[model samples]
Target: MSAFSDVELLHDFLTEAGDLLEDVDSKLVELEQSPEDAELLATVFRGFHTIKGGAGFLEATHLVELCHKTENLFDKLRSKKLLLDAEMMDSIMAATGEVHRMFGEMRNGHQPGAAPVELLDALDAAIEGRTVAAAAVVEQVAIQTASEQAHSPVVAEDDLDWAGLYEAVVGVAPRELEQAALSTGMATEAISRQAAAAVRPKAPASKAKAAGPATTTAKENSIRVDTVRFDQILNLSGEIGLTKNRLSCLFQSINAGVVNDDLIKSLDTVVGQLDMLVSDLQSAVMKARMQPVGRVFQKYSRLARDVSRQLGKDVELVIEGAETEVDKSILEELNDPLIHLVRNAVDHGIETIEDRIACGKNPKGIVNLSARQTGDHIVIEIQDDGRGMRPEIIREKAVEKGLISSEEAGQLSVQESLQLIFLPGFSTKDQISDISGRGVGMDVVKTNIQRLNGRIEIQSEPGHGSKITILLPLTLAILPVLMLKLEEQIYSLPLSSVREIIPIEEDRVQFVSGKPTMVVRGEVIPLLDLATLIGRESNPGPKVGVLAVSGDRACILAVDSLVGQDEVMIKPLEGIKPKGVAGATLSGEGLLVLVLELRELIEGKL
Candidate 1:
């Protein structure tokens, strides 16, 4: 009767229907590849059937009607009564997209209406193997809706008195009025049952009959908790870890002054146990936030197929390591970046069938997506076995866009030239289209990845293929930092950005192009002193250098000394961020260690 009472029902429907839509979407893409897969057809049919039933209960009028028609089409295809063709599949996919939109509206507290007349007409025609040659409908209209529950009973035929039934449904009427609905045709079963129940007299049941056992299964034991609650738990665990650190400090200090051997031994033992328990609790909380990356990866399968078809190319996307677990927040942020990369491969990286054939390669191009866990970081790679990028073309485009001069472009190495794509408004294409070529997406992709404290590297040959690698930290809440010491002040940098450490010798260092450089593995790496970057006056020495690798550049950071590494729980600053600090961490000795964002620091230096 009221929207307030339907909150739980709507939430349940959304949760179940959200999963069903994903299943149907992924299966619809597979069905396109193998149209004759009987099992896929049946599974997709059942997916829509179950969603429709739930929608009916919630009175999601548009969703129910849309799923109803799609279910019919799939049933026909499953039974071999109708054929699955390109046009038919397109119609079904379009309806699925509409259902997704309606769900969004419903989530925002807006009641969704019916599917468009054009779409409904197209689905109706599709079930009968007919085609609607009209363009896909862009606008939607609302149709009157009724909930399966809270609706008047339906008469099957014209055998009942219509006026009496209408009065009974919408107004208070006498018991005799309901009796008039009982005499009707077979189509009037619903109204007849309602009439009989309304006018019947109840009799008391026997004690033996009343003792019949109820039949019902207990629901599975579980409750859904918000992710924010888990985050609070993680924060508490970090506080506990800090307390353990303090206890450890106290335990060691008390032993030296006080000559209580038994007291020292008990404190040491209790501190050790608390340390272990705190570590375990922190790890458990981290795992609670971990979600399989496959949830985000699944949506890309359909994207690759659709974009490849639109480009008039034959490309197949092969996904690996779908079970790799990453932070749930990371997965959400990764969705759009991965999409841009996948589309770029389909549109710009992959060659058409004829072009691929001319190159003596297979007609279908292959796009590979793989993920792996390396220590405390997640690595995801997107590779395409098609014509790779040309450094020369990128150089010329850079020159044309005024991003670099002719002399500067000529001086760039092949690897350096490829890095120009990350510059805003850099594109080699002569025309613009819906997908790309307007110099928009690549720079944003790099920016978003970097915002996640991730680095992206591109490796491509002239004609072989191209691979894009994305390296991200395990969780955003905690960072594994390589602590570096500069006299009395300590600094922290993400270990993910630290490629290696090298000893900087004055004799071995030389100036190549008005910049200090050092040779490492035959590659010239830029060298920087930490004191010079931060305007700190210190005596230089032959100290160890941190080879900070961000994006495609490697810079050797000279520091006073190397401090041992540790996992630091970072506390984010609210406002007015410092010059080079991303956040600050408190060490066991009550010292504040400033965490450096290596990418930002390096960029500011250059």
Candidate 2:
């Protein structure tokens, strides 16, 4: 196969494997509830079987063997030879995790190491009713089988045609070849004889069968088209849009001058139809770049389980809206941030059994990881019923780290104090653990989220759990922003950050210690002049555009004017970072504008 074909095959495998892995995690959770579920057991077994088979074809031996052992264990359970219990479920889930890790390694061009020899040994012991080291693989595979009086015929090991079975099991030949062999009633030796007899003549038939399924499947679902092709399509759509605009302009000019009634009406109708077609095509192409959030959520199950076990805590992760779709590029960048957040929740956010007992809380803490669509944004929340943030302690830590002055810390609201945890080199952990609290993780999480032009907010109560919400655009490639003007230059602010645009009367604003303060709805809100913040030495405009910022603390941004709202394509500001710019966007009229980073702007004022 050509290089293109190889890449296409890999892409298909990745996409399918990703989905299966997601389903496996979800099913594992379901099995926890209904440990004796026959259908869930079968579904998980088949999923592992398919993965093992595919891994074999891809020459991923470690993955194949690991999954093979897992499949065997499930097979035993399904046949009513074992019992479903917590220990057994944990071991099986751990093995599933190993498979997931191996797949990741293979994707990154590395050879995966074998599953812990002890793990496999424990599995064997579980099958044979023996014990190993400290951990014993539980026997959890009992299922209801068909009644013995109506026993189904069982083919003896030796009675079966071993050679044909081997070929089919190993997938040495294409699926069609195996199907054709079954259909023709030809033994392995008979197929070999037929191949030798015709030599050249039979070659085409064999090749046809070998390549037929691959080709047809590739045409239907396997082909990995180049991203550049999508770019080219986008360009064409843009050109078509521009053409329609230009034609409309011409029609308007013609109508004003000559008023050719029939031609003008015909042109208008044609332009309308063309516009709709172009719009539909653009939407379709954009949809191709979207993938379900389940791809990101699935890996967390294994992480949550492992971390909980390691910490000797009983924690359950509940996920919702796994089918929520976001752009593929955004999904790719979301992995690390999501992992960090989930790990933090399990490690630091959720309390252990003893601690929970002391606090009079549930022994098993629950961590809810959910996603939902809000307007054009996808809000992903990680909420836990663990010991929540102590704002006073966070403030003290921030002061110790020299992140904030004592005076500044005193003025910080509980929410503002919680946000300080995300500051660089700041950690609330009393001691560093392998899981978290080294202070290096959350800063990276914040930066990565910001790089995607998303915002992160933290909400917590002293005794209640903490909730971290990450609001991201549906697609980072294009964003809806509110464009504004400062110093006669255009700028954009993400609509997610702009809670509302309100005009503040000059008299309503007062200066407190040379800082602007406005009382909106009986609450004193600090206002920062955008022009002054960006180092633009200009007089303040009559009207102040107040942008409501989202974070631990809320602030109002006073800008000169609200230019307008626009659907702008966000372009990253490379090299020299603009002092107060979060991103750059092109206006509908094709002009570049700097997007203000409200968080940074507010921070600077402090």
TM per prediction: 0.71, 0.66
Model 1 agreement with the true structure over 1-606: per-residue lDDT tens digits: 944248777777777787778778788878888998999999999999998888777767778888899999988898999888877876787787778778767776677867778889989998878876534642211111101101121111112232333233223342333234322232223333433333221212442233222111111123334677677677767777776777777667776686478766867776777777677777777777788788777777777876776677888888899999898767767866787788888888999999999999999899999999999889999999989999999999899999999999989998888889889899878899766789987887897798689888899987788999999987987788898877656779888789998888889798987988899999888888886665555546557889988776689999989888888877643212333556656665544466777766777555
Taking the tens digit of each residue's C-alpha lDDT, what string does model 2 give over 267-301? 77768867776766767666777777876787676
- Write down the worst ten-residue block by lDDT for model 1: 141-150
In terms of TM-score, the best-performing candidate is 1
TM-score of 1: 0.71
Off by over 4 Å in 2: 1-5, 84-91, 110-113, 134-262, 265-291, 325-333, 358-360, 400-402, 405-407, 448-454, 461-464, 482-491, 495-563, 572-606
Summed over model 2, clashes come to 5
Query: Can you list the residue pairs that collide in candidate 2?
Result: 77-141, 82-142, 83-140, 83-141, 84-140
